[model samples]
Target chain A: MKLLTYFFQWLMSLLWVVALQAQAQPTQPYSYPPSEVVRIHSKILNEERKVYVHCPKVDSADGNKRFPVVYVLDGDNHFELLAQYIDYLSRPDVLAIPKIIVIGISNTKRTRDLTPTNSLLNYEGKPDSSSYQGSGGNEHFLQFMATELMPMIDKNYKTAPYKIFAGHSFGGLSSLNCLLTHPDLFDAYIAVSPSLWWDKEYLLKMTDEKLKHGSALNKMLFFSDGNEGGRNSFFHKSLVKLEATLAKKKLKRLDYRYKHYPTETHMTEPVVAYFDALRFIFKDWEKQR
Target chain B: MKLLTYFFQWLMSLLWVVALQAQAQPTQPYSYPPSEVVRIHSKILNEERKVYVHCPKVDSADGNKRFPVVYVLDGDNHFELLAQYIDYLSRPDVLAIPKIIVIGISNTKRTRDLTPTNSLLNYEGKPDSSSYQGSGGNEHFLQFMATELMPMIDKNYKTAPYKIFAGHSFGGLSSLNCLLTHPDLFDAYIAVSPSLWWDKEYLLKMTDEKLKHGSALNKMLFFSDGNEGGRNSFFHKSLVKLEATLAKKKLKRLDYRYKHYPTETHMTEPVVAYFDALRFIFKDWEKQR
Candidate 1:
């Protein structure tokens, strides 16, 4: 019985080796392309943050090419999606968008970094202390991005000058805050259903006050909202006000578009909204090509 | 000199052990949850296939719940994109789509398996033997999917009855072919920019012949064409003909919609088309919920 057990164990080990060999051999059906997860320490945020970077297939043709970077907020939620989009849209045959690097900044404290002002007001104009704790860190977050994260990414990867900042909901508010305060940080901005009701529409007031009439801003902005409370809701009203504010400014070289998706929800809007935002920002890119 | 060499070797082995230990330990800066690459052998196609599966964050709330499967063709091109989309759209809060299993079938002789008929005709009605060499294996490919791939998937993964068949270009042609021939294979079919010019508009004829007037087919079909050519092109004509044929049939239970994206190219269409297709197919689903 002891001899039989030893023989069976040996046969099992042999089968394991055979299976490993089979896995190593390249078959037409099975190809495991390597995708790595990178982690870096951020001094400004005082926390070691992780960013998911999905680079394009680097063949001989694209050896020395530099890619534009897309820094997406809510990294854990939308990083993979944006990475996949960049990979597919930048294929040689499908050159709608350029090959781009995606830097997804995952969150530790959601309310601490993405909000502009640390207020306890909820969407309904009521005080919600628990939800709004540690808010108003948008400026600090942007500083961390510009000073710490961006520098680290630039030092590590092949990147271009053109950058895009994207976010949704609270992240959406962060995107707009960056656009308003640090317009030079990104070439384009995408805010899907931004929490404009934050601190009683603070961002809207800032947008109205920031731009001088007929100023040459030279930036691209894409913002949209979904059916938060049907067509005639306060969420839609705030979006309308923002659009009106932008229209009133008539800033030169400031390319902007506002889209309304009545059929999509606040959460579901990001998927279509982000795609449209890309399309809107790059509407003239294909024409130039 | 012999003692120094032994010390150097010992130091190297210690460093290797530390590196391996670092990789195994999930630390704060290195919290990379490794994704799995699953491979299954197909008996009918006589080929082994690989699938990249990223399941949701498995917590105590959802322990043994099964997921719906989304089988996308042209896996090499669009698997990661669909995987990311599925991940984002099926989040706990998002819940636009259900938690689903994604089976991306990578191409093996794409022209052979995606084209409908054995013909050497190009888009302009001219004979293009070089391009059409290994055409007309779609039926056999579908058989491989049904008899081999589907069973293997069912046996291995936790799958629900609901399945989606998606494809682009020639793969789109295969998707439509599967819909007409084997309607029971998938609940929803998405054909983005299908090669309608294949074998003298073979699938168009098949659509006209197979679907009876006022018949209850009980299927959902979403087909669209981007700007393959300008407005007065054969690609657009074929899509128009398909719509007309479907309209003439007047199938009571068949829910279908044809979308024309004049702004998008053959390559750029899928990004937006797929999103629109999903929304259209599930437009009423949300209301029901």
Candidate 2:
């Protein structure tokens, strides 16, 4: 009887230790979430660019799945924002949008690569020669993306043909410029308060000339401006004109939306703009999926 | 004549090489943009938390100056979004708000900490026993934040007393719960589509009893709901009840606002909600500053 009692006490103590271990070790850090950074060499730009890539938590069931890619310019500025949105929106519970691969392209040269025309003009149309000296190399930048960057990204990652090009300010101009010059590069374009006034409203004029009259240009475009001035401001006027130009063309299969954020500033526009852009681009996608 | 020509050619070639080197270097990778990750050990949760912190490009002109901190919940979700906004909005050109530090708190046990009550009831008022078995620990969670999390954050990072607590969904519920229970913890509270239906409107009952009628709370609360179940859904009804409760009280010094987004869904609300929440919270801050 004494031996049996001692053995029972030992068994109870062993169970307590096991219970404590289970309580303390809730979950392993590896099981939490995973995010990675990928680097690609761009021969057009002649530089090795680092991209912050955040993918959804892949389950074992869906091992061999491809995802739509959102290539956001100014990776340093908005990579994390896009990553967060994609993560939350594509959660198993949310199911607002499908899981996506967010590739944030950090900027190397803002003025040189993102602007449409080479000009020394600043926001006020004044020659800020020092700041704007190396402007208007966006075409080369797009070439870099088309021939070198995208191919490298495609070769490395599990990417679907469907891609999104997004940017803000000068970056925004680059996004629109890419769409106009190389429309096949991406499925959708998001220009958040694009600098249309760059090089004497070069892209704004280009928009009017690019689209064929009443012809099909199957793409989704979302453009917006925050309160750069008021509703009557040049910033607002430019976006309105872009909208009006698209409306006049009435191009078949061209889906576009222009939003005016009276409350947000030019700087704060991307936060809301990117969100709306994603929603706009994927509006039909959700229904179809 | 041959000697002189050869010397001139050598000089020109040297000058050409120097110019090429100057242009190719790429402006020292813009050293002013200092964004880095800081890992700190948290005693509260007993884990090392990796916080992605972004400070304003610290101007050498402003020596040893500190800025206000915005403690964003769901750090993994909205840290980058808020960081980008702060960086852009506080630019010399934009100047909408002062440069602020963003502290993104990544989650460990999100459901355990963020939810207010320990109930098995899901959103549909159905018991999901396995999913919510360890629920209703938000009070203890808040205590952990007050005693352990905040101090650790304040100690490691350059923080000011002026703090803002921002969250969405379960995080949103936690934010409101913090406001109601520990009003002194954060100066402003932002709850974007908070789970007020948690534990059969546990927070709704607590809000009425905690906040005295016509009393000075001296706090800022921003709450909003998207098209959760249309306008007449239980989610919408709870928010309306919350608004009505506060209205009936007429609490002095409690600056609050409720926004409704009919176009946005529960998943997509945070994008627009956060933007509007920041605008509302800081509406008077600009004038005051």
Candidate 3:
């Protein structure tokens, strides 16, 4: 009986040592592709703006090459996501998209800067006191991008003329607003599940009013909707209406594609939507030719 | 004319100064989710191996929580990709998948470690003098994972028993090989565009021989193919054959899914395949349940 107790005590001591060793092993952080946070003082917004920038590695053969820039909103959520996608898709083996700079615009006042019109109405068109109180400062946000942010980026990075504006949800609503108001700001636009229900479809109305039928607007556009509420939800209906409106315009030189993802939720749709949107925008990017 | 020349020279001097200022801006690296590289000596493989590990942040409420692990092949290509996906999917709002540790197994010898057979033939059933030499070390590789690497991970990290094995191309072939030879090793498996034409459909034939008809083999399998050659390419046909072979067996309790991406290339397919595979694997996970 005494020997048995001694064996048990020895086992406990070994266990304690093993456990301590496990905790003591040294670990170092893994390296990721180099990206940077660029804090720019925006006069239009009257505050300092922080943007995450991811530039592709300089090609040894052509060190002076310039790259296209993709300025994505809701940077805190989707900047790293886009940066990862661009890095993988633009690899020499993949070449699905070209090497480009990704500029993620982190938000300070999210609802204020993303919404186009001031209203307390939520997704259901019901007044929500807490959510949309300080909304509708998108015009100033665009000005900040155009005059302050864009000039700062152009003045610094090896950037090409081709630019893409991408966003999700309220950010998506602002993307459409930018397309309608400042059409030439970006060569392409991506709106992933834009909240067309905002202000009783404010951007939808503006898109129809601003775009002329049979007019040439040489740009690429990719928009998508996820199963937000259901098949008969306003989200689906709004996207269908947007597609119909675009089709009815018959605008020359406008290359556009609309995709509906029924299996994905609003939160999960960005994973696939951004990828498909990249494919649609770069459909003409034939590698090695 | 003299005044115009003097003005042009002054403008040139100002532009040079501005360019120099642009070049002088120092940007710091953006912070990503902390991941680590762990090196272990593998007795089975007779070499040292390095694996990248990404763990979820410890919840303040439950600091001692353990996580499911996903051991993915081709660490050089897909380690960061899976890490990013897991981080995004397991966010507070998204919560599509449970917080899990991602272990990316980096390759020392691509062909030797991933291939199941020693044949020196290429994808086209032709002998390639440049590639596929000194192959057929997958069994040893699995032994390494089972004995050395897995024990190291489980000993050092807070790990649960629910493991997943994910791979692409040759790595995918090895994934299937593991599923066949050691079905109990992983709870789930993801084979993205598996090279089924390896060694004259050896694994395909092995799958038919090994899995009993109408037997209970509870596992989640996700396999896919891209537009490698064409509609009737060997890559497509081989995947079709594997799907058919699995269906023919009528394997009971085997939750399997097959996807074909006609628009995606072999190299670009993993971008979407990995995302889709994760969704399929975690389809039943309800948020806030």
Q: lDDT of all the models against the reference?
A: 0.83, 0.82, 0.91
Residue-wise C-alpha lDDT for candidate 3, range B13-42, written one tens digit per residue: 999998898778656579999999888888
Clashing pairs in 1: none
* Order of candidate numbers by TM-score, starting with the best: 3, 1, 2
Model 2 over residues A63-106: C-alpha lDDT tens digits? 89988999999987787678767877787766778889888788
Query: For this target, which candidate reaches the highest lDDT against the unseen true structure?
Result: 3
Local lDDT at B102 for model 1 = 80
Per residue, candidate 2 scores C-alpha lDDT tens digits across B37-156 of: 555566665777666666667788657777788878888777766776677667776566777888777877788878877799988899999888787778877777788767866776
TM-score of chain A for the candidates in order shown: 0.90, 0.87, 0.90
Per-model TM-score, in order, reads 0.88, 0.76, 0.91
Assess each model's interface with DockQ, reporting 2 decimals per model.
Answer: 0.33, 0.12, 0.29
True contacts kept of each: 0.38, 0.24, 0.71
lDDT of 3 at A104: 97
Model 3: how far is B139 from its true place, Å? 0.5
Candidate 3 per-residue lDDT over residues A131-159, each given as its tens digit: 88899999999999999999899999999
Please write out the lDDT profile of model 1 over residues B134-203, one tens digit for every residue: 7898998999889887887787778889888999999889999999999999998999989998988999
* DockQ ranking from best candidate downward: 1, 3, 2
List pairs with backbone clashes in candidate 2: B117-B136, B118-B135, B118-B136
Q: In candidate 2, which residue ranges exceed 4 Å CA deviation?
A: A1-57, A121-131, B1-137, B155-157, B199-202, B286-289
Q: Provide the lowest-lDDT 10-residue window in model 1 chain A.
A: A26-35
